[model samples]
Target: MHIVLSGYYGFENVGDEAILLSIITALRKAKPEVEITVLSNNPASTAKTYGVQAVNRWKLKEVSAVLKQADGLISGGGSLLQDQTGMKSIPYYCGIIRIAKFHKKPVFVYAQGMGPIHKSMSQFITKNTLNKVEQITIRDEASKQLLVDIGVNKSMTVVPDPVIGLDASAFRSEWLERQAFESGYISVSVRDWPSEVNFKQKIVESLDLLARSGHNIVFIPMHDEHDEKASFELANMMSEKSLVAPGNLSIEEKITVIGQSDLLIGMRLHSLIFSAIQATPFIAISYDPKIDAFATIANQPNIGHVEKDDWNGEQLFDKAVDMLAERSSIEQALREQVMTLQSDAQNTALMAIDTFK
Candidate 1:
């Protein structure tokens, strides 16, 4: 079987890459002989980096040809169905599925997280496009509910995010080397501009408190540009007491670094997700509903939006400290949940590919 996998591939985002890695692992386990292809923004980078055949996103004629020859098109495991990132997100992703369907290819939306759609056109585009899909496996109950709210009546099942299925065993050696510095460290992974939150001040305050309590401070970025950029900015606004990981670390290296931290505070969705999967206690900073929903359903503590105007640097820091204090029990409570999530996510990929037959 020839399977064309689509998502935000070729991008330098570690979270998206982790999701792709998870799906590819599951797909291979299910069907070892299948030939895989990816739709990528930078075909060369993707092919060289991942060892998969890549086609440019804008190559419609080529895409059409691949769709005709491929057994199924898999729109992958990410929050690609939402428009909150930008207006172009919906049309760019949905158009790919529509194109695949135009050639009568089976399209499966696999382990996807759905909307906090802020635009009418985005909602319309997503709802209409999803209505035509052969199957959809949403990653969470909240995402599944969002699809129902949007009027997508096609068959849908709730699974966990594919990143949950990632094996920490892949980073065991790297984790061992970094574990010393993390003995009493508090790690923070920040992403997205929090217009509503005073991120710089709050994070600095949190780091200060943790430092005074004799805890070392480190930063992990789920995405090199997004999380690392914001983390650097926050580190600059604070004293030299904190350390931020280099922006050039690979996905496995980031996981290794994150695994060493005693506690994690993250604004990016996958940072917290990775923390959960690694059994690291975390507090999430929510800039959107998706972040809030992920934390809430996972039963994780979070300092969500305090409204754009009401956000206080001090208040946010205090919440994070309180969450950190509860780390041990919180981490213990999350194990059973994470185990179920891991199994469910793996099954989703297996089931999604089976839909093609």
Candidate 2:
């Protein structure tokens, strides 16, 4: 079976990369002899890293050719159907699904997180395109609800995010010794997002407070290039004992680093997801509804928007301290939830490929 996978691949976004990694893992487990092809922005790197045939996602001719030859196309496990990022997002992803359908190929909308699609045209495109899929499995209830709101009344199951099922035991990093990470080390992952002007400064204040309380701070950039600048800027603003991790760490390396941390204070969804997979307690700094949704699903506290007008550094610090106090119980709950999510993620892949069988 030749399956073409599509999404924000090759963007160097750690979260999306992790989702691809997990999806590939699950697909292979279900059908070891299946042939895989990826539509990616950076085809060469993605092909090399994932050991699959990759084609440029933007090249219409190449995409059509792949759709013609592939047995099926798997759309996504991320926020691909949303227009909140831009108007192009909805059309671009749905366009691929439309092409696959044109080729009469079975297209599975796999574990997708649906939108904040506010525009009427985007909603129409989403509902019409998605209704033609062979199967659809959403990653969250919010996504399913969004689909309904958009008038996509097709049956779709709610599954866990693919990364939740990734096996962390396969990757190891010597980051603890290399960075001299200490006993009470807190892993902080931040990203650049449109927010209140003083967001970075407030985050710096919270980290400073955490450091003063005797916790070592380790700044992790999940996407080396995308996240590095913001992480370094925040690190520079802090007077605390802190180390900014190298930006080029692999997905496994990032996971290992989060696993080794005493706690995770993160804005990236995957940063929090990795913490859960490792059974590490975390406090989410919400910048998107996806973050809050993940926190609610995992039963963790989301300390509100990181850049809200009334953003309070003291409130964030207090939440972190309170979460740390109950770390043991939190970790236990996270582990139990991860086990269930892992199973759900695996089922997502199995269901996607069932059409081939």
Candidate 3:
């Protein structure tokens, strides 16, 4: 069967890229002969990276032509339906689903994370478009609740994010050797967001404190272009020596790096996801609700809200110190949670693919 997969693909965001990889891997496992096509921002690179037929996501004529021949379109495993990022998000994703429907193709809304859609128009578009899809699976309860609030009463199953199902055994790295500068390290992942100007400085100050306490700090840029600048800037501000990982690391490499860390303090959702998959204990900095939700579900502490003025260096330092002291127990708890999530994530794919049969 042929399936057209759509989302924020080819964006070089490691989290979204990991989701794409996980979905394709799961689908292939279910149906070995399945043909997968991706709608991506960078078609050529995506084609190379995922070894799938990729078309420009923005090119309507090209996308419509592909959808005409596909069995179904799988919408997402990320926050594609949310307007918190921008007004265009909901319309863009819904447009793709509508086009697939127009071509008489089945569209599965796969493992989506729904709104912070505050606008009436976006809500109307989401409810109407989602109601037409053949099947829907969301990653969290909040998403399902949002759908219900928006009047999309269709049966929607809650599944873990696809990244939770990624097999970490395939990738392994020696933390000390790879980093070369630190014997033991904490993995820090950061992204640029519209926050107070001192946020970055505070993060650096916190990491510096950790460094003084004898933990080497490593900055991981999950999105190469967007995050690399933040990672480097934070690294530069630290009084203690730190390293910013190279931007070109593959998903596996990134996961391995995260797995090897002693602990992770992350702003990116996927950074926390990767930490969980690898059984690395993490402390989340809540830049978004998704971060808070994942932290709550995984039963980890969210140090503070990124948007709130109360998040400061001292609070972060205290949290890091507390989590570090309880590392062993924390890792065990994360592993147990991840095991359950992995099973659910796998079942979600099987259920979605079963519709094709």
Candidate 4:
């Protein structure tokens, strides 16, 4: 069987690539003979980076041909269904679903995170496309509820974030070598959220305490080049004595670096997800429902919601300090959930492939 997987790919977003990799790996394990093609922005680079065939996102003629020749299309496990980024994002994705259906190929909305959708036309398009899809597997209960609220049905099943299922065992032991850098440091990851939250103050307070206590400070940027730049800006804003991680690292290196943290404060969903899966202590900053939902699901109940204007650095730091004592227990629980999510996600993909067969 041939599978066409779609999402915000070829953008160098670690979370996006990680989800694609996870789904592809799951499919391979369940069906080794499967032929896979990824729809990406820079098809050549994506093909080169992932070692998979790629077609341009807008090349529907080519995509339709692939859909005609393939088993099913997988519209992935990321937040691609939202209109917050662009008006075209939802229509563009749902258009693929509609085209796949037009060619008599099944479409599986696999492990996707649903919206904060505000567009009526996008909603109409999504409802139409979702109603006809062969399967819909969402990563969190919050996304599932969002779909239900938008009039989609029980056709959806809960799958954990695919990143949790990634094979990071290769770098597990490397954390031992770099543990010294994080001995007394607090690590923070910044993302484009909670502009309403007092995040700047939170970072300042946390780092100030760590600095006063003679501890190291680390900042992790999960999104773009500007992330670390923002970190540096925050560092300077606070006191200019902060240790900012240079944004010169690759995704694997970023994960490795995060593993070296004593306590991680983050707004990036996958950063926190990876930390939990790897037995790292993390305090999550919630700017969206998914973050809060994941925190509740992980039972780490102390997630700080950054008010767009409040940016409470002290509260975040205090939470980070509190999390240090519970790392072992939190890690154990998170691991259990991670395994369950991985197993369920694998089974869902396998079952979807079986329908194609």
RMSD of 2: 1.3
- Which residue ranges in model 1 land beyond 4 Å of their true spot? 172-182, 194-197, 306-326
lDDT of 2 by residue, 25-141 (tens): 999998898899999999999999999999999998999999999999999978898888789998999999999999999988888878788999999999999889888898788
lDDT for model 1, on a 0 to 1 scale? Answer: 0.79
Indicate whether candidate 2 or candidate 3 has the larger TM-score: 2
Off by over 4 Å in 3: 173-176
Candidate no. 3 TM-score: 0.96
Error of 2 at 246 (Å): 1.0
Tens digit of lDDT per residue, candidate 1, span 136-218?
88877888888888888987887788888887866843543654563567778877573645555766776776776677778
Off by over 4 Å in 4: 172-184, 194-198, 246-248, 308-311
Model 2 weakest lDDT span, ten residues long: 175-184
Off by over 4 Å in 2: none
Distance (Å) between predicted and true CA of 63, model 2?
0.9
Candidate 3, 148-188: lDDT as tens digits? 99899789998899999988987965543555753668999
Q: lDDT scores for all predictions?
A: 0.79, 0.89, 0.88, 0.76
